[model samples]
Target: MKVLGMLYGMAVGDALGMPSELWSREKVKSYFGDITEFLDGPKENDVACNFTKGQFTDDTTQALLILDSLIENDFIPSEKLIAEKLIEWAVRTDAFENNILGPSSKAALLAIKEGENADILTRKALTNGAAMRIAPIGALFSTAQNKELSEYVFEVSRATHTSDVSIGGAAMIAYAVSASIEDKSWEQIIEGALNIYELASKKGAETFTASIPERLKLGIEFADLYQDDEETFTQKIYDVIGCGTMTSESVPAALAIAYYAKDPNRCALICANIGGDTDTIGAMATAICGAKYGYDAIRKDWIDTIDSENSVDLKNYAHFIELHKPQFKGV
Candidate 1:
């Protein structure tokens, strides 16, 4: 049931933040004040301007593709398979031949479309695209060993973002989701995620900025200092950790928000308020929080809105995961 919450949380966060993506923190604050409901994107923004209120963007769409692939394969699908599905998705959604795809994913998917090997194509790529769609992977293999989980993270991530930093970011999110589903304590979850980051860093994964583990630690400290002050906490997130599309910035920021918010709705709201790359951060943070809090924690209105607007079947996804749990027992 909590897995259902995690999936819906991803969609809710994605929809809640859709309008605020790419806006600066000040611009977001000045415009929305505090985004507690789904809103349409700015007319001037090409990427999301066409979307209606409560519509999720590519984050949820792509993650759903990964989820479908997992259900079909009964394990982590191969890079080639995932890459092919991405291209098919792009074509179906008209994201192909348009400038709608993310930098890393676009490059790798294009390379695969042109008959290049996915692994070779993504060897130097790094972006949050892989991490954005990784929650399903975590849910599918939550019981796997760390080494096995890391291997699966690398495999799926290499389809679009093969750089060590990108892979590391995906790994941490995957591990965190897995830990959250297992009902691990917040401290244990953070420690496990940080350990994964450290291991990936040691393996020469390239990072876009400061260490993610370091930023996460600092973010937790800031959260403690501003427990009762949402305004200061938000500003500090922008000032210290950042909230960009880069893996280093967004991944840690999402984790930090999850740690601070502790509740799925608050996590999504905070991510929406933080502005840049809000959809991805909100999706990531709220998924973890949802895993902790369960499906009942989410608002029914938001879930209904997402379903009606996006035509997604949240209960069907939950049933699929439940039915396929046995196949992943020893993985």
Candidate 2:
């Protein structure tokens, strides 16, 4: 149930955000012309993620595979397991079989194939790829919330995302989700993550808080730029956030959505609208909000629209694995 809550919530966010993945706020207003309720694909966007209307992309797929690997291994993950499971899941799905791996992940996997040191290999790459697939660490370690757990989650990320910001972002999100699962308030989760970030390397608590409003303004401003031309919404925000590469832009952009959106669905929709790494930010926000609010909080219609073969199976699989989780035995 805990697993389903996280995975399903993530897919809902991914699918919801897919339509307006790169649109700015004003562009979204112009595109949807309203957007009060759940809407379909973003108009004039020729991207594949948005091509299928309300659908999920790699973020949810990688995350679901991560959860599957952890559950299959009894919550203990290693570099080899992660690589193998990712390739396996991708090949089975036909999405990644056509050679569609994310840039950082592709590099990391190639390094693994060459038998390079996992630590050194991870440090060499600091893409959002690591943070993109890190939601399961939060769910798996939801029970262990102290500094010890924080350290373990950091180590879990270090195996793949060794850069300061990359690892810090993953750790922060994991801590927030785990803390939220424990029923902490939104402020509590954010502050807890801020405290962790402050203690770990260059990521400061004040920096996190200060970045929020700034990023939100950027998103809103980028959105406003498209008031005249909805067609340029994706490109304009992509220019602002530059969805091409780097975990810094992707992680923080995703965090911005969660920070502004307190509600589960709202967070998904808002993050999706922020653009550039739309699926990633949307997926991350969904994981955080889902962990906080549970599966019951996400709207049913959004859940229904997800790509069933990939999305629904993952949710069911995650839920089945959650049955043996000791913390959830009674609840």
Candidate 3:
């Protein structure tokens, strides 16, 4: 139930946030998108967003593919096979074109084109690329008895993000999800994530503090632009973070949503509505919620919003989880 929730919840949240992902508050306003609730869109420049209500984007699609690979290959994904599968899946499903890939992922794919080792390609292209699709790693390893779960998470994260910060960010999300499955409190989960970030920071993660004031101001400004000062809390972290491509910007923003939003759907919706990197933020929040609540707890209406009623295999995913349980024997 926990694994099912994390996977499916991420898909649901990713789909919900797909349309408004790249839209600015202004652009959203032009589309009668004042309300933050999930809405349908077939807007231009938003290919995946046009994927009908309940249809997931690359976040969920790539994540499930990774999960499938891990299950089939005994938790050690072969880089070549992984790349081939991703390309085939992208072409067959039409989720992405050649130009739509993230920088890190694209770099790794290019390495594959040049016949480089998959592991080498992954380790060299440290980016948020890997972080976006790691929810299942959290779910599958939820029962890790020793600290081996963290090490295992680092291994998976290093496939695409070897930098301490990126791996740390991935580990934070992975363990947060795992802890959620164990029914850990929100505070505990946040602290766990903080611990990972602190570890990475101490080990020389790059600092983006110069832009933090601007980002904090920007965050607060945006919140005020939409929500009155009394209703938003963006000002509190003004000195601590900034918004940018770095893990510091991305991860903390996602955690902020999980920390503040009072409910599962609410958390995902808030992250999506806030705009920048919505899918990733929404994915993270959904992962945490799914870990905490399990699959059945997610609202049925949200599940129904998924793009396919007849397709997508939750049961097979469940089977994968069952098969991997024995690997935890020694742990």
Best-fitting candidate, measured by TM-score? Answer: 1
Best of the two (1, 2) by lDDT: 1
Please, what are the lDDT tens digits per residue for candidate 1 over residues 86-156?
A: 89989887896645688889988887888877565466665689788888677766644677667777766
Candidate 2 vs candidate 3: the TM-score winner is 3
lDDT tens digits by residue: candidate 2, 87-199: 56655655433334665566666566566755565665556676776776666555344455455545455545665656666766777677767778766776676566544
Query: How do the candidates rank by lDDT, highest first?
Result: 1, 3, 2
Q: How well does model 1 score by local distance difference test? A: 0.82
lDDT of each: 0.82, 0.60, 0.61
TM-score of each: 0.94, 0.74, 0.80
Error of 1 at 252 (Å): 0.4
Q: How close to the true structure is residue 293 of candidate 1, measured as C-alpha lDDT?
A: 84
Cα-lDDT of candidate 3: 0.61
Clashing pairs in 3: 54-305, 54-306, 54-307
Most lDDT-accurate candidate: 1
Candidate 1 to truth, TM: 0.94
Candidate 3 positional error at 152, Å:
2.3
lDDT of 1 at 288: 91
- Per-residue alpha-carbon lDDT of model 3 for 1-331, expressed as tens digits? 8777787678767776767665554454476454355566545635444455566667777777777677677777565556766666756754345334566666665556566655555544444666677777776665333255556555554435565556666667776787788888876776666555445333323433333224323443444353434134533322234323455565666665565653677767665655555677678778778768888877777776663532678658767876785565422
What TM-score does candidate 2 reach? 0.74
